[model samples]
Target: MDAKTIYAQSSDIKSRTYLEYRKDMKKKAIAELEILVWLKSKLSTLYPKQKIKVSKSSGDAFLWFLRKGGVTREPDYHAMIDDKDFDIEFQYADKIDLKYFDFAISKIAKKNKKTGKREPHQDRKILYILKNNHSFAFFNPEWVLKNGKIGFVDAWRKDAYRIPRNKFIKILESDPTLKSVIEMIDVKNYILNFQHDPIGINKEKLSFLLQQIIDEQKIIKIIPNDLDSFFKVCFILDNLNKAPQNINLWLVYLLSFISNKNTTEDLSKIIYCVDFLYSKTELKYNELKSLVNKVKECFKLLKSFEQKDGSFKSSVNLSPIDETRNAVFSINLLEDLTQDLIFYYKTKEFNPITKIYQNLNFIHNTYNLIKNLSMHYYIS
Candidate 1:
């Protein structure tokens, strides 16, 4: 069946996805008094203002400011006091802004040897903007507060386990949008993509390739052959189950099993029963090599399938939560596997430019994740 037909069959899905987002837009707006209160505190401490006007995507709401010859600006949150602009980002959003990552990671930069001068990084440029004749505070967001870390990505991503702790709450207390989102994550009701439009992949090609991946999963299935091994694996995964019917958990379970089998070198049945189609376990030497090559190819395919907004317009499950988030974790897993990448680089298959691009992509993707919160998780 055509995917568009399948999608069109369910009006409820689109409505449910978008309608909840509309409802949240009202709730998500930064409270006027809340910002006023924070600004008042900081203003009293550092810079004093006759009156502060909270800026928005559109022109500022202050009737006086409009009359005072102000223009619309792109700052996430900005203020005008004493006829000067203090454009700021009030670390009050869900995903850390990538601009903040641009600030932290380039803490030290590579200098130009010829010029004998310190090279400037992107964050330094932002700092320059702030420290100009008139200054502004960046209003430190949660990601910056934690010092440029991934947040709630998956069990494999370092920040996932660490973020749920209580210490991160203070960064969010000032903004109701940030505070309410944390409340939602606490209860497991945070709708990460409910507000965004679906970024479509090539439906026909994606559907075909998606079916292929599913067939591969069955062919190179990860569950152990032994009933005892199966139960042991199940016990561990059962303990880690945080959400109901979460297929992401299954992907992690398979990965855990695969991780335990990395040592298999021979054409051995790697801690598993044979898949008749693939003949041997994924961990077997030749079999693993073949699969890794296949995986490398699929990475290209997956990148092609990815939408500009970094979402695939498909699902492997019908669970209530967005499956695209799980898809992102899959991307991160594939990306984080340095072993495959090292092997690929050593094989001398890719051109010099491709190799350099592949190396730089890790940092690029990490910062990209910071800006796009759809798949990324909120820490507090």
Candidate 2:
């Protein structure tokens, strides 16, 4: 859809238009999902021999599988291994709990089933399977599989823990065999932290490290390398908003790395990146306001889809986590808009044509109604 069309539709101000918008959004979301599935299928066929396993299950399927296998709900496993020869004896089931596989492998050694004793096995050549485009694997701190070759693990941890970061990076760059595992590790470690700590790593240090690794690579392998990537990255980055953390360093590094040309196509990243910068208490109000204005423009450009019931679906094929997060993000944005309206009112800055006050009032009422409806769904 064109920007003008979205702007015109979104500016209708009538409830009927809002409902139509939401319905259209849902349709768009479904279309996007179909396209993504088609693309994934094509990619899979291209790599027919890859060890990655694809599952059609929704998010609940993996959890259900683990629960059926008698795995505990709490994260308790300490060791994991993917090597076929590495036979880890377990009291329960043959398959490890997917969520806790990393934790499990880190803590315990593979054992023989009959003797219940640790067994020495090949440290290299781990196996991984794909589920719904995401990949998972098992690894131990002492050893890792790289390009079908066994090698000692090298990576670093925050505390007293020692990992082979240099070796890991080297293998990741040169070894195609270990590429999937490395990517899986990066996705798990980085993507999962998007909500809690997007800027957890020091910006300068991470940039330097990433650059060094990239320099050694003949081809780069970052996924979703478009506007979608920016959204995913920014979504993770914004999760760092509520803390005492200064994400400016990280934000700067990201902006520099991604560059201006690539980011222009996706102003949402710019809006979010600006928001991160303005959020710093040290930043001047004028500077922050400029960023906020940029965000407002970006928002104006955003396509709003409405359902028949006047509710909006901000995302398509949203996972449980995404649904919860989108709701929270929408509510938070509305709250911010309310705060701005109150500020304007207090300053006697009246503008009937802009209709800021009226819009804010409508938003408040809409949000409360939706929240009440949500509660009813849960309670019923």
State which candidate has the highest lDDT. Answer: 1
Q: How far off is residue 94 in model 1, in Å?
A: 17
Instruction: Tell me the whole-model lDDT of each prediction, alpha carbons only.
Output: 0.31, 0.31
lDDT of 1: 0.31
lDDT of 2 by residue, 1-380 (tens): 11111111111112223223323332322222222233334335535654323222221111211201232332211112222222211111123232212213323335578998544344322222333333323334335312122223333222222224343323221223333433333332222222222122223223333222111111112222344443433333333222124444433433433322322223434434443433343434443344344434433333232233324344455333333323333323322333433343231222211111122223333344455555666697
Give the TM-score (vs. native) of candidate 1: 0.24
RMSD of 2: 22.6
Stretches > 4 Å off in candidate 2: 1-274, 281-290, 298-308, 313-328, 334-380
lDDT of 2: 0.31
lDDT of 1 by residue, 1-380 (tens): 22211111111112222223322432333232234344445555456546655443233222111111232233334566667655453323334322332332223233568987444332221211111112223333334424444344432343321233233333232333234323323222122233122222212323333322112223223544443344233322222221123333333333333432222110011111111112111244544454455445534544443455434434344221233343333343243232333333333332221111132233233334434553444432
- Which residue ranges in model 1 land beyond 4 Å of their true spot? 1-285, 316-321, 338-345, 349-380
The model with the greatest TM-score is: 1
